[model samples]
Target: MEEPQGFFSTGDGCVGDTVTERCLVESKEPVSHVQLACGLCFCAFPLDGNELCVWSTKDPSYQPLILRGHRQPITAVTFGNTVSPLLICSASQDYVMLWSLDECRQKVLLASPLLSLLVDEKSKQLVAGCADGQLWVFSLVERHHYRCVTRVDLKKKRETFSRRVESRLCSLPEENRRPRAHGLEKGEDMEGSLPVLSLAPCDLSLLLSSECGCLPSESAPCLWVGSSAGLLILNLANFELEGVLRYKDFRSLSIQVAGSCAMMSKAGEQKAICLLTSMFGCQIAVLEIRLAALMRSRQDLGAGRSLSVLPRGCVLSTSPLHFRIAEEHRTPPAPQRRTVQDQPLVFHSKVRSSGYATAPHVTMFSPKTNTRNNGDSPSRRRSSHRWCVTNLHFSYSFYAGDGRWLACGLANHLSLVFRADLTGTPAVFSGHDGAVSTVCWSHDGRWLLSASLDGTPRVWSLRRAELVLCVGRDLFPKPIQSAQFYYLDAFILCSSGPELQLLKCHIDTSKDEIRRYKQKSRCRPVFRLPTAGPTEITSLSAVNDFYSYLVLTAGRDKTVEVFDLNAGRSAAVIAEAHSRPVHQICQNKGSSFTTQQYQVYNLFATTATGDGIKLWDLRTLRCERRFEGHPNHGYPCGIAFSPCGRYVASGAEDRHAYVYELGSSTFSHRLAGHTDTVAGVAFSPSAPQLATTTLDGKLQLFVAE
Candidate 1:
């Protein structure tokens, strides 16, 4: 079998010659499995061979390192979950071997034929799932000793429960004549179990189709075990099975590989969690998991002390199996070279329109005012009118995921969507009775969500330029401070008063009032996350990546709270983040233009009134860098990371935007075009375009020269 070559897409929205194949690794014998470790190296094992080959992709000239220890063919291999990618575990029938690449040492553990392995670095635990329905848990003592914690027999546990339920039902008196359901087997004592095929640590970042944030913390950790029967979710807190999920249509599914990704739903622009499952490399299927409903049901089951399995209602909505055909290898296409800008960036002097531009060139001042003095000429009057549209400043602004559009929330109770270059006519979304505070674009860039002081969070269809869904203001306790699309737009996250609410909603644009009302009724709150402080939340930020589940929020009490959406709990807190309430928080959404390491995406920045911006690493929970010199006293002075993640751009009270290099503390560039305090800044995801909104209702557009 030939190994597939690795390729990276340029993401330039081109169909031909967009993907470029980098390198190809070859083996003398056919490789059985290959796994990449830390995005630096990979290990490949051949079938019917007792040795595995490890190659460092960083050095192309280096030869593959052969590691031999297993007496039998390796069944499974996994890299250790640690800060340093030095340890790896290989499983076989003889024993499970843990190898340290740095020291070239191995620790062997006598165990059964393990099919799957999971290493928990934080908890110092390792779980091995065998061909039989047995889960062996081990404790890693001081990174060397491996002591058996407990052995869980999933098959026996299910059998025991089924037998007890069957005996109780049989003891009851038989009913007279009853309508019977199809496939109802009489006296069926047990639900059959399947062998464990694969295992992955339960991570909200991994399960929710987001993988951009930090690793899973040690609190309430869980594991996802895939088998032919169903996917089993086991709570590592007590090493007990918490929930079992089976597809709605399929009775038996051989889930060899199971993962989640963001995909469009059949109903309009709503996003859904697509569960991709592979069966023994022969069959593939894509199923949809209603994450909000499933999570709600999980909580109800826990409250009722029924942890055997998830209800059928929580089962995924089944879809037809999809088969993928392998394409033959062909000659590589010529790569396209893009022209680089001559200068780094250039800012425009004239004020650019942001919101609700009805008349293209309307005269705001009267003819008498323009003729009064030479300073108040027609040019000056036109510039002044453009600078203060609707007499309302922008409250927030964000660039769309693809960098093609920009969304801005204004104080005049309106939301605006503009082209990145501010060339096309702005798409105005109205209806809010108060100032629009939060503006967020959907991952697909088809929808825009805005939250206002009126307490309503409205979803607007960008294509139709209409409101598709809106929540009542009476439903919330206080005004909404922040709102955005979370979990691939599967849930709407907003902060109201001191509570953070997660809502799962469906977008219905039906003309029928009754049908629209029914669809609106289907929108429900999955959970609420409250701040640790007594006061309300001041700011919040979360990455838009599909595999990120970490939501970072700031409190009025001068603290930063990190919530793990996967576990639905506060994972960590950074107290006294600033002397005053934190005003803004921004995460480094890695860019396609630059090749960043896996850990770079975990970095974030926070700023507060009168305080300088501080960069933090989510993994270490420590401040890595402090950027000062920019005067930010009253306004929030929103900050944003450049597309390449190498620079940070922030608004300032000095009537300018400051750009700082990540390695240095001093400001690198001072953008001095704004006439008032800069309110917010946004960087284009696809290009070197920077947009700044000022307190004087002026929008400035900058592009690479």
Candidate 2:
């Protein structure tokens, strides 16, 4: 298998990137580079007969916002700055126009046949390139109205002098108008309008989305204009010419882009601009510019710390470059182009207004006003305490404080399924793209943390019914096998990377625009735990009870690491703690009467090794005993302990839960009900009951007699 760009394979040939398609939008035309913001995607393309069109990203199989208004084929399209609301501007031969996101309406701006479009977030200015060899920068006083800062005619001096052509100045129309013949006929149209060959708007404030800068700076915004004649860079600050680098010797190699240009940001530190020119068939030309020097030149504007600097001196190249599109992307069928005749002033469509409904994917389901079989499958049973709610299977479940809230780990997301006291369906929290590996709830039941193979742990608020924070890969670029809150506050300990990591995190509520409380981040990661190797840490368990301030972790390395907060770092290390990869860990308070004395001990168990659950004394950091009745078929199946610490509970791959009396070290009951491997087992803090989640999506509650 081939690795993606920017990724490297390990000595074992394991690369970090996973190949998966999140969504697909098949169109009858070639799709431009897509930009996404505020849960929406915007793309522009020329459809049947080069009809310029704009489509908003839609849910799978959902009808997209087919925005139409451009009179001629589009040259460039881009979205507004991230801090600003959703605003899309497009430039074409028809003139410059602004399209409101979601609403299907368009407002005509300058009537000049514009070539490119860009919005400077700092000054709130709209900049465009014209086909008549002129540059126009419009200060957006409000909307639709633009007062031009300046305009420059870009016709070369040699061309003007050689032909003795008296260059006529282009007009900036005060009102909306389209060029046509003087004589009016029923079917007459304008064929003189042509697209500006090349235009690209590179914003300076886009660095806000990357967070590489500590502070926001004025992006001394500029436009890179390219034509068959040469390349010219214009300053948007005063609409002045900054520099012009042309290929006088290689004249035949410079036919500019007839469509839009693309940016490759992740492939290299330098922001490389890739454009497909009309001069060569399937040939791509890449231009890499140093924005730091440009920013330093305009440092008065928002320019953060110096970014990357390309060592190259030349800005223009004549060598043919090929940008390979993946094989999965087929060459869009080129439809027959209709003659540019009988052009109408106003473009009509099925849409009357630009208003569009929100995509259906952002849906939420709360508890019911009238309750049913609770959190169980509908066909399972109808008891009050035990209900059948769904046919969908779950891999893990946990009963929060007093057994009021039951959270189950689903596919990439998880569910906060309440007990029978509450109504409605469960609240599903989604973000991760990998299967949820482990889940833990905070002591007060306000915060719920779920770890996944997606290399991050998502923080979900049970009170808000929404996902609050995502501990991203930046904190540690390793799959989070398990994660837990240190207490109710403080930081979090996640089992990832070489061993474990401490992430500085916090959450709080803020007033929204209308003064309603909304959860937001107070801080992010402050530092990371340092380790030596690249081996994966797969399991984590920490004691938050009054019993102790200790943490236990194990994984593929077959070693158990215990971290004592009060004493600092691993208090002890048990070598060869498991024969195989450790899967799960459960920390509980256990009391044993030994030698005519009642002794309370800090104990934890690991579902590792070919043997069953192995119980260890945390105080001594030694294995107390191994319980081996349950079938050890899967990697470290789930293990749990009762709140009172009287009984030890665990689930095996054979779909059986083995409960043993800790004092006797003997099996007490063999619970068999699930159709598949029992992924997790949890005991209620207040009630004498056990909850089990299976791979077949079953959530069952078992009560102790």
Candidate 3:
């Protein structure tokens, strides 16, 4: 038996076809808790309480990786450091389990009566934070038993130190040490005399203890603690209190230090990585504490600095604190440095405000031939101070001829026209009962046409600031989906229900009557335009000459159809126009021209779907190219061609407006800062300025570079 041929096709000849490509621009980084290794691909395992799922960087889909066996929700998971990679540590409530990745077998590493557990690099040590505000460090041995090696008992440790100091002072000779020394316990000597307490048996020499509220650094095992008075650093090696770093009023929640150095292969070398945190947004501090630096500081304390060093061939630096020494006796160490790692992974509980300064707006010039600097000497300048209109709620906006006036259609069924000079009150025209879906002004700037969800189309006289006439339901009795008016002929093409209708308006003062000349419907309402099943009409736009052509309509059926008014028939049908529903379509007047000999006129502009924006040429009914720099996988909500035909600006559901240079087919700049979806984008007819409206009830004006 022969296998059936696949239904999918490739290449350029057919309409309603599909094409796929990898995206080049990246959106916001995905939120994840644990990352997995897969060669060059970085995958994140996202946990939502009980489920364990993995998502890769190359693909958007996520799948379940592990399930069952975990009595409580897994807090964290990490792979082993070795190439053989047998162990995978899973931290859960009160315990951490070491599981063999190949066999899927598990063994309890450290069982602490705590809420959370964290395993160190070797999986030989585990750190657990308990409900009693204490941290427990546990060690595992080959005998299959866990031992508590160190316990940071924060409860009443200060009180116990006070009593011990009092007893020691009483035994001192009266001539050598005065009784007044008892008050010194409240200061410096309090930390130095505290004894190091061992919680369990371990061969390692280091044992550090301090107050409850602090975290350990990556390089040094020195735990930084914050008390009611100031910051304290405890040396983990000898359990001695180190020097204080900083003093502050509020107790520190977290602290990080940063620096930079060349890579080295040997231990006791200087290295640094910049550290940032939620506590301080952009301020970075240098963390300069080499093994040599620690050893020198120890010698300065008269602790006998000549400690036994590790063998030359030893790769792992066992004690991070012992490598530091004074610079005078140093041989500059070896050129080999520890491999620099990525930034430490930390979970911040508080939101941090951005620290980036606002950039001053600058201006440049764009001539017909080439772009050039506008002034005598090109220099950046701050934009003019203007009041931001915060009360306006507009879904879309457009400028009239020469940008003398800006017209915006709001969700409240009001069309407002503001003077470009920003001097007078904006003219308000309200006629529709529902939201105004679309609004546009005539080419001559005499009339404005608006379509609303109220199932009517209204024409407003700009000079009078009043509705002159209403179309749709009064004549066709169907809801007007979209409408556009021609300034020269006073002809209007409106999409009503499933049909495109043409209407001509006339006014007679003597008869005191408004006359409407209705032409035949260009496209018949066949199949109800497939309201469902991927065939609903999404957008409609008109070309330059209304007498020759009436409208262009795009639908979810992946087709663009041109309606011819003169011939009273569908002029051309461009099938398979987009991958998804085309939400917006606009005609480029400058590109829509043909010579007598060529017999080809192309309308160059943009159409949008859920994927991205595509530049289309109407003559061949083919997509010439695509603009692919939207940061999010957003549905394009609005698009417009610059008056000079040099740029195309598009708005998306991602709350950003992207401007693309038409000649070079590259992105010009991104206009962000919108708090909600950008519903519409428009360019000024006179100046190098653009306007956008968002769902957050705000209007923003941008000047081009």
Which candidate ranks first by TM-score, i.e. highest? 1
Residue-level lDDT of model 2, residues 211-330, one tens digit each, is: 322223522455666665444455444233343434342345443433444333232243535454544456656656555433332222212222111111221122111112245554
In candidate 3, what are the lDDT values of residues 518-607, reduced to their tens digit?
322222121122222334465677643222233577765766776544334565565545556666677654211111111112344546
lDDT of each: 0.59, 0.49, 0.45
| Candidate achieving the largest lDDT | 1
- lDDT, residue 540, model 3: 77
Clash pairs of candidate 1? 209-546, 209-547, 210-546, 210-547, 210-548, 211-547, 211-548
The lowest-lDDT stretch of 10 consecutive residues in candidate 1 is 302-311
Model 3 residue runs over 4 Å out of place are: 1-51, 54-72, 75-401, 421-423, 472-478, 508-535, 545-547, 590-601, 632-636
RMSD after Cα superposition, model 1 = 26.5
lDDT for each residue of candidate 1 in 222-322, tens digit (9 for 90 to 100): 56766655566665544445445544224453453443212223322222334554543545566555544433323322121211110112212121101
Arranged by lDDT, best first: 1, 2, 3
Q: Model 3: how large is the Cα RMSD against the reference?
A: 32.2
Model 2 TM-score relative to the real fold: 0.42
What's the lDDT for candidate 2? 0.49
Which parts of model 2 are misplaced by more than 4 Å?
Answer: 1-401, 420-424, 514-519, 530-534, 546-549, 566-568, 589-601
The predicted structure with the larger lDDT, 1 or 2, is 1
Task: Assess every candidate by TM-score.
Answer: 0.45, 0.42, 0.44
